[model samples]
Target: MKPSRLARDAIVLRRAPFSETSQVVDLLTPDDGRLSVLARGSYRDKSTFGGPLDVLTRGVADVQRRKRSELDLLHGFKITQPWRGLRRELTTWLAASHALELVRAFAWPRDREPALFDALAGVLELLDRARERYEIEAYLTSFAGRVLAIAGFVPVLDACVRCGGDVADAKRGWLSLAQGGLLCGSCSTPDRTAIVCSDGVVRLLRRALGGAPDATPGTAWTETVVSEARRAIDLYVEYRLERPLLSRRLLDRAERSPSREPVA
Candidate 1:
């Protein structure tokens, strides 16, 4: 029996050539979560996919799912938002890539994640307009924080994870990755596996984790605040995921390389 064809709005996450004229594509859809589809003859010049089927392309994917196989057949793709702005800047492009990598890592196939999909779409649209490196970093951090919370890994920032004491008024605290949140001064000891955190960092984390997915904070973050926020989020994510991300390494390399003119 032939499987029924399904169509859904999807964002391309990753793609690779599978054969001389075919490709394997990873996509994130609101209803389907993360999916792998085989696009036959997509490499051909007059392929039915119509436009370039690259990462970050938002489109409607027509897929035919087999009853016993994990890979689905992609009949066609109709592009909606190509996100052309991302191609104009290296930082923004890399930032978007990093976000997609996180989704690919954490999102499960066939899991319903409409909220996660909306959050990702919101962040990508913001990244398209971000002008500074700091803005890009801030947005990426925000995206990570939100996604982590959506995945049930919400970090404790309002109070001590260990003792439940309010640390909102405290001057300093400790971020414990193993404990999955902040620890008050009373609960944090010298031997604890934690990172010393300032009140400012805690506040930033609180906002990032709990703020609306479409909201960008108006606070002006100093280089120190930006660095600390990024470090904290990265460390927490790595600890939870049990490994570092490849896209993060690439992003670090790009940051260290010679500077280029800011994207207009």
Candidate 2:
């Protein structure tokens, strides 16, 4: 009998040495949300696998699933976007890492999410050419909101979660990560929620609900809006996902110049 063959465009999310000559790769594919594949003899041959397996590369891969969990043998691969330029810039590198980490967190094997995959590809591409920190921040927050929506964690940013009142007037609200979204001023006290959000912050978040990957706060104002939104989205993502993203942490570390304190 012929062995099962899987082929798709994949983004390398996480990769590590499996043995002396092989590697374990976590992939986010348009057809398969997140899957682990082994690249056998990649490190040894350095010809077939080459170096496309590096994290953040966009490429095509041929993988055969196995009963064992360690590594999937690679049959073929073609590098489409090496993102070599991004690797040279630490900020861009960390931003791309955070995006991939989110992909790894929310998506699972055989769960097709073409839009999210494309968003990720676009963001990684942006990181490759990124010139501003604000750009990456906007993209990451918007992409996080979009992915959460795709995974069905769409937060209730528009109205009260309890009484269904318009969130337009509410001065403050609570966000229940387990409950999934905002509790207006009225319902929050009853729930004794863990995290509360200001109305301005919630409105900023509402702007994010539309899933505009390139939309940052207008330039007339300072970056305070962008900064707050980024923190809120980061906290919201941590609430829903498996763990805090390593890339986000790394990006934060990189952005903190020696002369300044880290922005909250």
Candidate 3:
């Protein structure tokens, strides 16, 4: 039998050159977690795909899902949303890229992740319109929290992991990545893998992980609070994933450089 033909709404997660004229593209579909398809002659003059097959673009993908253990064929991809704003600013680009990296790490081939995919799309859309660095960071932070929680890395934040005492009831709590939660004043050890955090940061994290990562709390974010909250989430994610995301590292460096500009 011929390979089953499928056309799904997908987002370009990543892509690479293949066989000079062809390309290997990674896509995230609402119904299908990730699809790796070979786009034959996509770089040719008479290519079936219009424009460049760029990353982070959303489109309708015409694919042939093979039965045997082989790469699927991509006959066509009609770009729907270029999301050009992703590359309009360095801060936004880095945030968008890091989010994609996190998605790639969590998404399994052919597995369904509809909710995660929707969340990702929403976050990307918001990132494109974001002007300030803090706004972009908030969107990414929220997305990361959602990704981590979905992947079964829920950290206990309301109370201390060691003593089970609510941090709100104590003077303060220490964030312990290894123990995967907060340690109250009485429960924290001198040598534990704990980072001192403020009550405001903890509240920000709680709101972010709960949902609505795009919802801005105030007219403008409390710069310090949002930054600290974002940092804590990223550290937790890195600790759980056991490897630092290269995009995240680059994002940090780019953020520090005042002269950096968005790449076209």
Candidate 4:
């Protein structure tokens, strides 16, 4: 008997050539989590998969899971949001790529994570409309915070992860990647792997974790705040995932280029 067909709203996370005419695609879906599907003849001119099957393409996929195999056969795909705006800007493209990479790494296959699916969709739209590098950075930071929260690894921003002391009342805080939260000055030690952060940086991180994605803040983020928040979030995520992401390394390289837009 043939495997039953399943359809779900999916966002393409990664796609690579398989053979001369086929491609292997990884997709994230609300109902199905992450899926690996084989797109037969997807690279051909008369292929049913029209347009580009690029990363971050939101679409519906018709697929069938083989009886004894992990890979699914992709019957068809229909694009819903191509995110054309990201393609126009290099920074936006990198930002979207970073988000997709994180999703692919952290999200488990066949596990239902509807909230993460919604967050990725929302972040993609935000990246598509972002006008500045700082904005994209803010969105990426926010996206990371949300994804971590969904994965049950949210860093403690309001209190010390070690002592459970309030961070708001402290003059300075330390971000402990291993402890997985902010550490008050009194609770921190030289031996701990921690990043010293200012009160403003703590506040920004708190807001990023708890605030809505589209809500504009009452105060603008200074260059220091942006840099500090990015570092703290990146370190925390890398610690939780136990490895650094390639997309993040690429983003760092791009930012170091003389021709790249000034993040500050």
Candidate 5:
């Protein structure tokens, strides 16, 4: 009888050496959420993969499912969308890499969330097409914010999270991690760990929480607003996740130096 097998369209999020010839690949799928699969003997003279299973490459995967606790077997992976444009520039590559990292961070193993896959797909397309660093950064920031919002971990912004007072009319508000949202002037405390955001930033944040449809090509945000949003979201994500994203830090350093050459 033919062996039982399945196929999924997936993106290679990460890959690590398994046993010299084999590898373990982490993938994000629209239907399967995240899956870690063992590619046994992929280095052999006759391999079944359609192409080299590189990171950020979207492809169809042939897999064998075993026990939930065990790694799935990657029978073959065939590339469909290489997203080669992502490799042409430094920011674009970093942005795509960062998106993958963020996906892996929030998406649980073998849990399905199609929205997550679509969001990542959208951001990758945006990053690949955008030539401007500013535009790329905007898309990246939007993706990060949307990721937080989609996962239902974002703090409240409409009212003071502490006192439940209206902040809609306020010129600006502070996001208190402790309070789980924005804080009105009366509730703001000096000792609290919080992020200060202007009304413009708040508006953008609000738009972001509803999902990031506005992140499309024709949409726009000022550099200032984008910067503020990026800073706030990065801090909030790091605090919530309990560790900093290494890709984010590398991008930050690269962006600060106008004369410095990009490594990628």
Candidate 6:
């Protein structure tokens, strides 16, 4: 039987050159987790997908599911939000790219992740209008927690993953990526492997994990939470992806440099 073709809205996570004139687009759709589609002849002049394959660009796309395991065909695409403002700001662009990289790394093809999709949409908007570094950081932090949650690696924030005991009173806690959640002091061992976390970090994780979608703490704490949260989530992603994230390294360099230019 022929695989179904669907019209969906998607975010372009990454795009790579295919042949001399085509491009392979990796996208995150609401219904599909991660999809690789071939935008035929997109690199050539007079192309329909010509100006819309940018990372972080949202669009309505026609994707033909594949019978085998290679790139599927992109019958058409229409731009929703180009997010051009992000391009002018280096930090925002780099940060958005890093987030997108995580999306591509973690999500599986043909899986439904509408919540993750909505989160990404909000993150992009936040990155675009972010005035302070904390805003960006907060969004990324929340993003990391949410994405991990969506990927089935929900951390034990409300209570200990092992004993199911309340963690609200604990001053310091440990998060185990390998063990797959939080470990209490009694349950923790020398080789159990966990990240040292403070009350603030724990609370932040708890909020992101448990809070309502529309509810977020004010932007006052956005930066601090975002920075700390980035480190924490990166640790989890590093363990899960099990390889060096090239985009993260690039982001580090971008963060340090005086020249805030978007990397091509």
Question: How do all models score by TM-score?
Answer: 0.90, 0.84, 0.92, 0.90, 0.91, 0.86
Worst 10 residues of 4 by lDDT: 255-264
lDDT at position 106, candidate 1: 80
Off by over 4 Å in 4: 1-3, 214-219, 258-264
Residue range 1-264, candidate 5, lDDT tens digits: 535478888989999888878889999999889999998877666778733468888889998877754699998888889888888767677778889888888999888899899889888878878887778767877898789977889778888888899999998889886657888988887627777888888887877766765643456677778777777777778778889989888778767763323434
TM-score of 1: 0.90
Model 5 worst lDDT window (10 residues): 255-264
Instruction: Report the C-alpha displacement of residue 31, candidate 5, in angstroms.
Output: 1.3
Q: After superposition, how far is residue 182 of candidate 5 from its true place, in Å?
A: 0.8
Best by TM-score: 3
Q: Which stretches of candidate 2 lie over 4 Å from their true place?
A: 1-3, 66-71, 171-173, 189-200, 217-222, 258-264
* Clash statistics: count for each candidate: 0, 1, 0, 0, 0, 3
Better of 1 and 3 by lDDT: 3
Which residues of candidate 3, in runs, are more than 4 Å off?
1-3, 214-221
Candidate 1 residue runs with Cα over 4 Å from true position: 1-3, 190-192, 213-217, 261-264
lDDT of 4 by residue, 1-264 (tens): 644697789999999899989989999999879989999998889889884478878888998877688788998999999888887766677778999987887899889999999999999998888877777777887788788778877788877788888788776789888888888777788537798888777877887777545323335777668667876888788888899888888877766662444322
The 10-residue segment with the lowest total lDDT in model 2: 255-264
C-alpha lDDT of all candidate models, in order: 0.82, 0.72, 0.82, 0.81, 0.80, 0.76
64: Cα error in model 5, Å: 0.7
Considering only N, C-alpha and C atoms within 3 Å, which residue pairs clash in candidate 1? none
Evaluate model 2: give its lDDT. 0.72
Cα deviation at 131, candidate 4, in Å, is 1.7
lDDT of 5: 0.80
For candidate 5, the TM-score is 0.91
How far is 237's C-alpha from truth in model 2 (Å)? 1.7
RMSD of 4: 3.3
* Full candidate order by lDDT, most accurate first: 3, 1, 4, 5, 6, 2
Structure candidate 5, residue pairs in collision: none
